[model samples]
Target: MKPLHSKTEKALAAFACICLSAVLSFSALAAEKTYRLTLAETWGPNFPIFGDATKNMAAMAEKMSNGRLKIRIDSSNKHKSPFGVFDMVKSGQYDMGHSASYYWKGKVPNTLFFTTMPFGMVASEQYGWFYHGDGMALMEEVYAPHNLLSFPGGNTGVQMGGWFQKEINSVDDLEGLKMRIPGFAGEVLAELGASPTNIAPGELYTALERRTIDALEWVGPGLDLRMGFHKIAPYYYTGWHEPATELQFLVNKRTWERLPEDLQEILRVAMRTAAYDMYIQNAHASAEAWEEMTAEYPDIQVKQFPDDVINALRSANTKLLANYADNDAQAKKILDSQQAYLNKIRRWTSISEEAYLQGQ
Candidate 1:
């Protein structure tokens, strides 16, 4: 028989093997664990670029996590509440949400600033404000109290002014005009004596066709083509409101807290990548759709609002924003941050993008 010391060593080696095997088994189980999240989006099923952003985000997150993270998306059709996404996510009825931040302006007044403002920065400039400037911090301040975290979901670079039944010639033409315009822009239009109403996306075409609304601004050519607004409305005005219409992804704070740090990072990177992809996709789709629209419908009149009308709207927008700033401290903070950033970046935009476009 072996010496007692040798036997003791052998016993220790066996015990060590068992401990190592147990540790390896525990790690394997940990690696196999999965986390699932549910998302509610404001758009309808397969709703093109807007809907695609959510899908892209979910796919990226799942793939990046190597099947450890999975996200299920419910469109408006499934959830049956396009505008209620904010409340659902906030209440923890949904783990996440995809919608426009400005949609919640009535419920949360400070949310109005997160989406595009009238005469606001363009997409690139607004994105810079979001990531490189104080935009994200300001947004968090607005959302943190509500048990929600918001991020830029996607963007429609520069939305069209709207589809109009009649041409707007002067400021007077806006008087008593019933339009489906949402967000702070609606408030601006209200100040200008226009009746602005927010309508759900599914009902917009019917509302406009039925004369329930004299005009409506959906997205640009990218989305407008599918809605066939040109078939009914002869005139399409250029954009003024929503210069960079950014959509939002909202997360329930509780749900976010439950995610591991690695998963949280994955979600963030996925959302950001999806948002950028949607912006590029929209731009390309708009270009292609515009060509198709012009070719198929020669009668479609692409018109710009008169200088006096634009100037009047711009003046009204400024005054209304001032009123909001005066009424609410949070609004003031957000507005101040956006304006300061806009003032700084617009100089570069003018010399770079504006000059380049003019030269082209």
Candidate 2:
């Protein structure tokens, strides 16, 4: 009887050891789990508002995820391909990217609509359209073929038309004119016989100064002043194109799918909040900088394109859009949706903000 009792005690001890080992292994696996992603940005390192957006998003995501998720961003200077963000994210060379969707128009023509339109809704209205309307779904559809996801990363509200060495007086003045512009706006300008070119941001100042490009449009006074374009070009035109220029965050779909549901939601929230934050930050900075520029340089001429020029540009934009609508089914769908939403929202704007401003 004593021998049998010893055998039973040994068996029980073995079983307990097995259970303990399994529990230890489970805990170890859980402890080791973390998601790390690499991001590429179109902007150079420390590129102010644009660069800040990515930094803010990464920081927020890390804090929210409690170290379970980490993001590392490589700016244009590191990657050496400012305009190649779309390709990098698609190839999974980098897990994510920050850029403008329009930059990829040559590769994906329909992508041109995702950034902004010539006479589209403003930042607030466009945001509403994105979240509450089909804007997001349409954007996803356009990017899906490339095996990537895109989000609204930031906004530069109402971009200035551009800096010009020569004043635009009539439609004919645009003939043979060279400008640094991008997206559908470039297309619109191209229709008017202007040579619309896109050069890297770092090279813009040199190109403008050397007459490689006659005119260039960066962001508003908020960003353009820092680039020192005002020191070279004298004409500062108000915005007619890109009423709300939104930048993009590109994610590799495979990398995104691997994340746990909690981390995914946290990332989405972080990016969304950061984008809205950038919009407000830019607005405040632009206002302050605009005032500063005007005071510092009384000789800097601020002018609008003459009515004939404006009419010609607007007509060109309308005709080019019509051509897209006729040729590309997807472009037509996206444009139709945007126009419909803009019509509804601008009506509200006319009664409220426009009315209030007019009275004031």
TM-score of each: 0.94, 0.93
RMSD of 1: 2.9
User: Candidate 1, after superposition: displacement of residue 218 in Å?
Assistant: 0.6
Q: Pick the candidate with the highest lDDT.
A: 1
Q: Model 2 over residues 18-100: C-alpha lDDT tens digits?
A: 99999999977765578899999999999999999999999999999888889999999899999999999999999999999
Question: Could you tell me the lDDT of residue 182 within candidate 2?
Answer: 96
* Least well predicted 10-residue stretch by lDDT in candidate 2: 1-10
Model 2 spans > 4 angstroms off: 1-28
Candidate 1 displacement at residue 181 in angstroms: 0.6
Q: Model 1 TM-score?
A: 0.94
Task: Report clash pairs, candidate 1.
Answer: none
